[model samples]
Structure formats: structure tokens, C-alpha cells
Target: MRNARRVILCLGLALAASEPLATLATPAEAFAAQPQVYVVRPGDTLWGIAAHFLKNPWDWPLLWRRNPAIHNPNLIYPGDRIVLRYDAAGVPQLQVIQLRPKMTVSPIPSYHTGVMLPFLGSPGLIAKRSDYERLPYIAAADDSDTIFSNGNRLYVKQLGNLAPGTLLRVVRAGPQLVRPSDRKPLGHALIDLGTAKVLHDGALAEIEITNAREEITLGDRLVPETPVPEPHFFPSSPAHPIQGHIVGSLSNFPEMMVGQVVVVDQGSDAGLVPGNVLQIDGPESVTRDAVTGEHLTLPGRDVGSLMLFRVLPEVSFAVITVAKRGIRVGDALRSPPPEAPKVLGIAP
Candidate 1:
């Protein structure tokens, strides 16, 4: 069932119809200093606004919980003002002041759906990684077909004695790349395609695809859904140093920008945790030294920032929250020091 949209009638300060609107305070310490009022600007998003106020874009889910007064966060329109207030306990709340024509932006599913579906490639997002295992690989299609889609019949091996109606998520082993340091293999990139359900039980199983975000080819793997990692994690700068590379991108666009998801070779094993913000550095710019007739290669500067969310053993996925320019594969990743300036080129 579709959940009912949330609604809240705000209770706070009122102004004289003739009084000029107040100036909004936006210092980083606005919450500690005084009540901060932010007028929503064009191209504003809940995700982007959260990063602007809280320095943590993915924490918009937390902000949603805190701001029971702003129902239907996505309904926020350009020119609407947001007020940031804190309680005695330092708990912050954001209140939306609707003073303009109501406008709604892109729809984002509830929290879990937003995080899980993308990394898993379930229905809405492109496949990012793939996991291969010896067992449970697709053996054949019901009609000797090589390709499959939602509602197509498939026979999968190694699902021994599974009960009817059991469901499985399809995956594929994407690629194997080695860590440059010790020549150790970073784990296989696992691509989660869609889901299937069992119809017959045995050493092997007959299953029907219930959904397919992408084409399911023979040799794709299957996994029982349940242990999908917890999606909510506190957003913060990395507690320690983190270094890695932009191993891949799922958005498929040759150029990526804010809100795009990128795969990083760094993970928990490398001291990376969810919400750890990292600076993205682009390729070095090689320039010619006019007088010396020599080549000068300048190091890449911080082009943007991304927050690590889903962590695998050797890799993690992060969404770019700020970008001065397009993000690319092979960009270097580095953890920023605490209180470091984060947004590059984008204003707060």
C-alpha cells in the first residue's frame, strides 16, 4: 500500500503583513548562534539543502525525522523559507515556511528504498556491482532462451529443497581488480539485477523473475534477500585518513555531477565508514613552461565531495553531494580534516 503523505501545520513566529521579511542567517554555526532562516532557492533539493545546513547530505533522512513540521519534504518549492531551530538538548528541527506557490520536485522513495534499491539495482537504478558464487547461478531459461526479464521462467542450480514462493535476488560477478599496494584482490564487484521467486523445489529450482532492472543473462548468480545491510548511518568526516580511487560509476553518463553515485576502492577494511566525506580530485593538468620549454604537471584540486554510504569488504559506494565540475572515473579520493571546507565552488 502506498503510504499516506505526511502533513504538519507549523506553530511559530508571526509577522505583520506590512513588515519586511527578516534576513536569514546561514553561518555554519547558525544553529548554535541563533535561529537560521533559509529561503529556498532555485535548483534546491532536500538532499542539497541538508548538506548546506548540516554538512551531511545523506542525513536528510534524519532531518526528516527531526522536522515533523515540514510534511512532504519534496513538496518544498523554490522561494519557500526553511527555519532551523534547536532545543535545550541541542536537537535541531527544520520548519518550512510556505510563502510562495507550492511546487514539488523529483520523488524519492522512503529511506530504505532510496539506499538499497540503487546499490542492488532493484527496479529503479542501474546495476553497480555483481557478486559471483559457485552455487545458485542461473542454469537455463524455461524455453531455452539466453536472456530473461520480469515474469520469465528460469531454472537455477544449487537451491536445494527450497520451499515454493521463496524469493531470490539476482546478481552477477562484474570484474576483479587488484589493489595497487600489495597486489591483493579487491572483492568482486557485485551487480544486483532484480529478483525472482521459486515455483518448484529440488537440488535445482524453478523460478520466475518478478522484476528485472536489467537483463538477466545465463550465469548470473542468485542470493537470498534479507541481510541487505542497514541503510542509515550517521554522517561525519572520516575519523582517520582514507585514500582510494574512483573505481567506477553506475550512472552510465560519461560525465557525472552532484547526486551521482560513485564506487570507491576504499571500504571498512581501509577505515572507511558510512557518511565519511571524501574530497574528489580530478586528473592532473599538464601545462607547458613557456620560458623553460619544460612540462609542468599540476596536481588535481578538490573538484567535489562525496559521502561513503554502502560499505563492502573492499569497496564502498558514495554519492557526490558537491561538485565544482564533472566527476570522472580514476579521480583520487582523500579524507578531509575535521572542520575543513567541503563544498568546492558551490556556495553554502
Candidate 2:
């Protein structure tokens, strides 16, 4: 018994020397609180949901990283309940409990990780306005070749320090896009023609045309390429009330169909995000009063919905997910299509 007491006294002194002077809890631990449960409402988004719990919306990754519960943290559906709780360590955690599965299969291949495409698109496409200003231009083509096509060599000028094998998109900077309602110029429509691969780099770089959707011509600008965005960009109603019109169609079609990309005048500057879904509608004339000559408007008809794939400052690229009617340029795009009018019924 005496030996055990002496050993315990010595062990206690050793443990005291090893005691930490300061203890700091992790960031998640600092967020300790009672679990706050939220029921996902119509038009709810993972981005908005994360923002609701975390005052700093951008810190959402902290709540989801390494979490075993959410396989795809970016995607969540309405009617799902999310819990914001603290663990035994007092660390905060975000989890989802779905009452029903809410995934819809899309026709287009939205994401890929296994097979490789023969070609990769522009790496520096997601860029600022300044990057577009000094874009390279096709100075000359193969000898006596007035038009550029696939596998043809292009003499490009104004190219910076691009290494060999860099990808670029052949385009024509069409026009300064302006909002019709306010005549506010947003961005220029850089019509995509095709893509090219940098063969050699220099003051005047040599590029080999890889894919030619349209006839690549001299003076055609080779702007940076934008790739397919994240798969988290799902279709959902816009967060803020939005009213705008289709400015242009990527296909240049007067009337567009489902599964096509179109440009809308509204963008991030107008409260639009990458996942926002806009309602497409068209209005018809109800009738003209015979005596007064006043015009009456028909309730706007819902044509389709556009899911944004990319968002710029004042312009966005959207895909017509569901085309109930023909989508056309100048058609109205609303956040949530106005509800259908209804009347009370009387029973005899």
C-alpha cells in the first residue's frame, strides 16, 4: 500500500508537468447550441439554407466537410428537414433527413468524371472583364486560306504567355449587351464558333483548330473558354423577385426549344445565382374594347423554365429545362411565373 501511494504521488507530478497551459476549442465547437431544425420550403437551396444557419454564408463548407451523412452536400430538396446541432465536443454539424427522394433525371449528361472527352475546353474561361479586352485575334490562316477550319493552322496575335496545348474558343465579340428596360449595357455577346488548341507559343502563337462548329475566319477573336459548371446548379425558383427578357440565343434560333442555351438580361447584379430557375412566359392580347379602343391583356401564359448554368455580372446563360411552348427572344422571364387566376364557386 505504501509503495502504491508513493508511485501515485510521482505520477501525479509527471502529469502536472505535461498539462497544457492553454486549451482552444475548434471553430465547430465554438458554435455549440441547442439543435435548430429547419424544414425546407418551396424554392429552397443548399446555398440559401447554409446561409440561414451560418451567418457567414460562405462558410458552408465548414458545416459539411467530411460529413458522412451528406454524400452530395450541394444537392438537397424541399420538404427535407435539416438539423443544426452540436456534438459532445460542442462542435457544430449540419445534417439532412429526407422524407422522400427528390432527384429528377435529366436528359443531358450534366456531370462526368470517368471517361475523358477527346478535347478539354478553355481553362481560363471563368475570368474578369479585363481578360476579354486583350483577347488574341486570328491574324492570318494557312497560305491563301481565307476561311479557317478544323486542323488548320492559325497565326494569332495579342496572345500572352499561354503554354502549348492550352485551349481557346474561337468567337466573334458580337455587341455590347444592353438591358432594354433601363438601356443599361451589361456585357458583350461573345458568340462561340469553335475551339482551338495552342500548338506553339510566342509573340504570335500558332494554334491548330480542333473543333470547328462554324467557319473560323480571319480577325476572329480567340477568347478564353468557359467549361461546364458544377452539377450543384439544380433548377429552383429565384430567391428574389425578377423580371427580364431573353436577350439572345446561343443557337441563334428565332424560336428556341428545350435543352438549348439562351441568354437572359438579368444576372448576379440583379440577384441571380448559378442555380436560379426563371419562368418563361408569353402574353397574348385578350381583346380590344370596341367603343373606347382600349387594349386588354390576356393573363400571361407559361411557356417554360430556364435553369441557369453560368452567371456573370449582368448576364447569365440558361438552359430551357422544360419547354411547354416555343421559347423566343424578347419573351418574358420571371422569377416565379405568376399564379393562374381563380374564382370562387357556388353550390346550389
Candidate 3:
């Protein structure tokens, strides 16, 4: 009986020692698992490459945590090698291990030149008697035989005590201002007053209103003009367009029932072009904490998308195709991400 007891005690000790060794070996084996590497191909955007391993593209910012060389999150070139590692549960994680030389090439710089305009009401009037000195104006000829009825005549009510031969601009308000031209008053013409007249203020001025094209009217506003700078064009759209600020709106047309003619600050100079699609974003609301009396601003949510149909020197026009809610003026317009695979699990 004593010998049997001794053998049982020895077996139990051996089992306890072997159990710890087995547990340690399992984790060591997992650590030795090789990571998968993928080479980037031409025309492959970072978002595109990330999607192959990740279920969500928006989680791309998380990649920076693993790769320190990727300074600009938006910049990832072809021929770059990315590593994919799987956790013990077989969950994959992506990390940019190396960037090929060609992928690190810098892009050429583009010129940014354009004008900024305030939001104007649709069919808004340019009332007479407003100061238009040293301001830009558009000229239109009147059809009637009345003095200054022809388009050739100068009928400025805003130039106060200004001398003759002062250069002015002539612009006509129409659909062209809000569409393809994007508020850039079409057909800029120079104004030359033929005669001088006295007004109620005893100020000597040239108020001749001639209808050269038979379209000039008595109420047209006249202002000084400035030349548009060179290299004026729209900005090219990013692979993923994002929302930006809305600066103005054109609501005068009957067809514009939805107050549609809203103008945004983004344009060709900013890498935007005609036919580019953009996503409209708005501020989200968060529930207030009644006890703490604190209000939280929720993350911005996608509200709608706009398709750029017309582009101008500094502005562009897009029509809203889809809107979960009404798109308000001043909302941001941005490019949407390309269709690609997403990181399996990520926080948006």
C-alpha cells in the first residue's frame, strides 16, 4: 500500500509541471504566425487597398497608428507593400509596412485663384440709388427710344460725385448666373457716358440710358469693375469628395421651388470639376444630459449628395439628387469615398 501511494503522488506532480509548459507553448506558437503582405498596384488608392482587408474604409485613420511613415493619410501611392496580421481569433488587421519609391513621389502644385461672393436672393433686384462706385456691374441695352433707353447709354444711380470717363461694368441677371457660369455675370461690357446731367443733389453725372441691345432697363444697378485674375479654373475632385460650406443661394426662378440655387465655396481651384459628385453633410444633434445640464454636439452625418453640373472660376453648381432631410444653405459639400472593401470591424 505504501509503494502504490508513492507512485500516485509522483504522477500528479508530473501532470502539474507539464500543464504549465503546454499553456506557454500555445501563445508562443501564436506569436510566431507570419503576417500576410500585399503589394499595391497602379491606380490603387489607400482607401481601396484598405478595403481589401478591412470591412470599413472610414477606419483608415487607424492605420496611422501602425505605420509612422504615412504622414499624410490621403497620400498613398502605387507599389506600396502593406502587411495584414491576424489575431488569435483569426481577425485581420492592416498596417502599411513599406512604401515603394514610386509611391512616395510628390504631386504637382496647382494654382488657387478665384473670387468669393455672398449669398444673393433669387430674382433679387439691383435697386437704383445704391452706391456702385469702384464696384463691378453688368450692362444691358434698352429697347425703347427714351433717353438712355438704348443699351449704349450709362444709367448709374450709385456713382456719387464721380467724374466722367470712369470705367464701369454692365451685367444682366438671368439663369446663366446660377447655372453653368456659377454667378459669374456673363457678357462683361465697359460703360462710356455720352452726356452729363444734374441730379437732386446738384451732382454733375452722365446718366444717358441707351438701348443698344434693346434689353437695358431703368432699374439696372451700375458699379465699378475689376478684372478676373489669370489661371482661373476649378479644383479637381478628390478620389473621395467630402462636404464643404454653402455660401449662397438662388431662389428666384419658378422651377427652383425648393430654393435650389445654393452656391458653395468649393470650385475648380479647389480640385472640383463638372460632373463630380459630392456628399452633403450637416451637424448632428445629441441628447442633452438633464442632470448635468450639458449639451453635446453629435458627429456630422451624411444628409444628401450633390452632382456638379456646372463649374466657374471660383464657384460650382450642383443639383441635389438624394436628401434624407432638406438641404439648407451653408451646408458643407464633400466628395464621397470610392467603392471599395471596408475593414471588417472599425469605429466610424
Per TM-score, the best of the predicted structures is 1
Question: What are the per-residue Cα lDDT tens digits for candidate 1 across 215-288?
Answer: 89998887776445434343456767788888777655877887667778878888877667788888789999
Candidate number that wins on lDDT, 1 or 2: 1
**TM-score, every prediction:** 0.65, 0.59, 0.34
Model 1: lDDT of residue 139: 88
- Residue-level lDDT of model 2, residues 147-204, one tens digit each, is 8788999899998878899888887655556677998766666667788989898888
Instruction: Give the poorly placed runs of model 2, Cα more than 4 Å off.
Output: 1-134, 226-230, 283-287, 290-294, 337-348
Give the lowest summed-lDDT range of ten residues in model 2: 6-15
> Which segments of candidate 1 are over 4 A away from where they belong?
1-49, 52-82, 85-112, 118-133, 227-230, 251-257, 337-348
Tens digits of lDDT, candidate 3, 1-348: 011110000000000000110121222233343124557565443333533443332334444545455444443334455555444555454554444333344321111111121111111223222223234222323345433433344334445765555434333432222222244432221222222222221132444432132244444444443433222122223544444665444443322222144555666677776545566777667877779979877767877655454555556655554466777665666677554423322211
Q: Global lDDT for candidate 3? A: 0.40
Local error of candidate 3 at 45, Å? 30
Sorted on lDDT, best first, the list reads 1, 2, 3
- Full-model lDDT for every candidate: 0.61, 0.59, 0.40
